[model samples]
Target: MNQFDTSITFPNGVTLKNRLIMSPMTTLQSYYEGTVTQDEIDYYTRRVKGLGAIITGAANVEPLGKGWQGELSVAEDDKIAQLSKLAHSIQSQGSKAILQIFHAGRMTFPATLSGEQPVSASAVPAEHRDPNTHDAVPRSMTNAEVYATIDAFGDATRRAIQAGFDGVELHGANTYLLQQFFSPHSNRRTDEFGGSIDKRYTFIEKTLESVFAAVDHYADRPFIVGYRFSPEEFTNPGITFEDTGYLVDKLVQTKLDYLHVSLDNYKRVSIADNYKNQTILKYLHRMIDNKKPLIGVGGVRTREDVQNVLGSADLVAVGQQKLVDPDWPLKLANNADDAMINDEFKNAIEYTPLNAPLYDFLVERYGSIPNI
Candidate 1:
């Protein structure tokens, strides 16, 4: 049997329809104020069909956490009505809707956060999303702010449950706040949230503690929770291969639904001496072997690419390819002919929601997003 055609149940008793999932990709379709727009609803509704689960673009858990212009916001109780619209849009198509939650940390702009200085583990600066404030230096978050962020994550999860989402994926990857705390290069503090590798994971552990507590209290039926992380960093003394393994070990023990390894190429291996030859996905797979399922993503475009990733991971997720072909999984299930697949690109323009930043991003940076 084709691996993609099969269903798998997680330890949480939540079962996916098949082994294909929709990876979260920012559409830039929300209101600048962070409300879910009708266009955004239409955008996701088109892609949610046929996947086992669709993880929505990263939504900020607090006002100061917004990373981009159109990022979705879940920082307050009032957002539930609009969030429910999003949840209904995806789940109505029979696929599980999982909201990915995040705090941008130093990746955000001061203008985005209403004049507040961006907060991080330290007063470090990196390339940010806004060109105007690419050089903005963030302040170190106080201990109270740290705990409040953790609480915000829980409140956001509870909001997800109330909004009718099937699950939530903690956005701990892509150099966001969670990864910032875990990276030695970024987290040079001497506190419990930094310094040692074990201590670096304390924030994530506490965040998950709050998340699972909300899940236990709010979810009436089987709900899934997942965590995504980038494997290693290019910076010196940043998250090393060993550090990633250690973090994954701790994450798997939490008994979340699955662990997602973020990669630019699923087959890309480490250049570091410690992890010589094997692909990073395979390296991480070994660490979580028999412990929990892993979701692999990267340059998965065609059926061949899909199967290649599934070989390394329990399930395969698509981001750029999903933009090119929203109905790709459904077409594969029917064994649709090449003519149908080729016609997909022509229809893709309709599926890809139009937003100025998303349009420019597709055209400029990721010229790989096919027909835009």
Candidate 2:
């Protein structure tokens, strides 16, 4: 417990109260135009009291990049005020808030953003059929368009700072825009932005550099910049753990704040189903040893499961479990013996609307929810 009580420090001298981080999990409850709503402010603030730092759900960088209905966006200036309110709410509760900036690429459907054609590294269509609705194949992005996309990330990062976030996290995992460029199966470009492994990473490298530069100039706060990257493409051949290691090694030299290591992109249904496998954490521990702060996330359900990887990783991230119990970090920190999943809370999450009422209700009642 002594080691666990030790303070956790991120790059740029940002220190957290503890090592329990609330991982970024998407909640599509924002205004259709992607503005932050009052419900969102309440939802995030509810969990801020007992956590180290909170990484927000995916915030689209551009309209065409949106992947879900009601998801928020940081692309526009008007949204900054709402985002600022959300950040202040979390900070008031004593938790640092990091906005997760993302572009969905081909995973976006036309229905989400006014029939706009989705863009990706290459023209390859996604293999999985849409759960919500059938959609058209996405078009491959041109070289110029790729560079423009990088610029969009920079713009979004600047906007996040304006909105009062403690930092910004580049969403590079789950076969999204950034991951699309990293996968050999997805990125078939022969240009400098693709081809060899080093070339394939050019877009992500450039995006990070550009965003860092923007944040450096516009914001005076000690901003932290980290990345969420997939270490492997489980369903795709030629994309193995070794290849991911090479990519991570390259990113380490970029002098970023943290590295969030995830195993498979969300497109892989089989791997997504078996997330509790301890082997994923073991592999991540072996791949990254640079002393940089690392956050490991998968299907972690119990407190012991989190403690098992405490020394091996800097932060233990829980998504589904947290949805079932927002007080999960508090329970684990205090070593409560009776912490268990509230089935009612789980059912509530399905209809929770991704806003404050649900979270506020949970905070008001900290016991297991009886079935309605």
Candidate 3:
């Protein structure tokens, strides 16, 4: 049997139809008010046919957590209708829909939150790699506000269940609020949510408690819950592979269905000085040791790449390739590689389902998303 066509079941008894998943990439196509636009639905509908599951781009759990313009939101109950449409669209093509939820924390801007300052574990400002961009120093989140944010994550999970999604992926990666609380660089608090690494992980622990409470109460059937995280950060005192090991150890003890490590390349080695020898995916695979399925992503554009990633990971997730060729898995299944888009395809927009906004975003930042 084709390995990619084999079904894999998670620890929670939720099984994926295949070993391929669509990485959650922001569309920049949602409405200004955070509602799901038809453009977003059409974009997902076009890409779901041959995947096991599709994770939607981060949806802010609260208004102040909005990361950028055109982001999706699960903050209010009214969004359920449109969100249901999105879930239905993906599942219509046989892919399980997973809602990726997050709070941007210090990664957001005041303008994006309508003049309100962003909040984080500490009043730390994010380091911007781009010289032209200036970031604001976020205000420290009050103890009460911190608890509220945790509750907000739970609320978002409940909304995902109401929206008919098959699962929810906590957007703990990407320097978002969850990562902010876990990173020593972003979390300098002397209180319960910071100080030691265990304290720094308190927010996530409590969050898992809250999220599972919702799952226990609301989910009528087996519903997958996954956590996505970066293995390390480039900043001094930022998250290290060691720190991620600790985090992963804690997460595996929870009811999480899987662990999704975010990376630019599936086989990229560790960036930390002492751990630079091993590929992050392989390192994680050894650490996880089949405790739960690990989803590895990055630069998977072809059948060989898919098989290579699946060698280390139980599932392979495609990011930019999905943008260039939404029907990649379908074509691969039919042995139609000759018809697939190549890196030289400059007019990909004319052939793919990329809406104007996402197409423009990819073109403007072509360096990051190869083969635009």
Highest-scoring model, lDDT: 3
TM-score of 1: 0.92
Clashes of 1: 0
Residue-wise C-alpha lDDT for candidate 1, range 258-284, written one tens digit per residue: 999888888788867978778898788
- Residue 8 lDDT in model 2? 76
Report the lDDT of model 2 for residue 251: 77
From the highest TM-score down, the ranking of the candidates is 3, 1, 2
Please say which candidate is ahead in TM-score: 2 or 3: 3
Q: lDDT at 348 for candidate 1?
A: 51
* C-alpha RMSD in Å of predicted model 3 compared with the true structure: 2.1
Residue 126 C-alpha lDDT in model 2: 67
Span of 10 residues, lowest total lDDT, candidate 1? 339-348
Q: Whose TM-score is higher: candidate 1's or candidate 3's?
A: 3
Per-residue accuracy of model 2 over 1-372 as CA lDDT, tens digit each: 214445777768888777777788766668889998887887787777677788998999988889887787998889999999999998896778899999999888777769777888877776665534446467788888888888889999899899889999899988898988888877888888889988988998899888988888888878889999876675564356677778778878786888887632212222443344546555566567745778776666576666765646777666666676677777766777376564555455655444464454444444553211
The TM-scores of all predictions, comma-separated, are 0.92, 0.86, 0.95
How many clashes (backbone atoms < 3 Å, residues ≥3 apart in a chain or on different chains) does model 3 have? 0
lDDT tens digits by residue: candidate 3, 43-122: 89988989999999999999989999999999999999999999999999788999999999999887898888889999
RMSD of each: 2.9, 5.5, 2.1
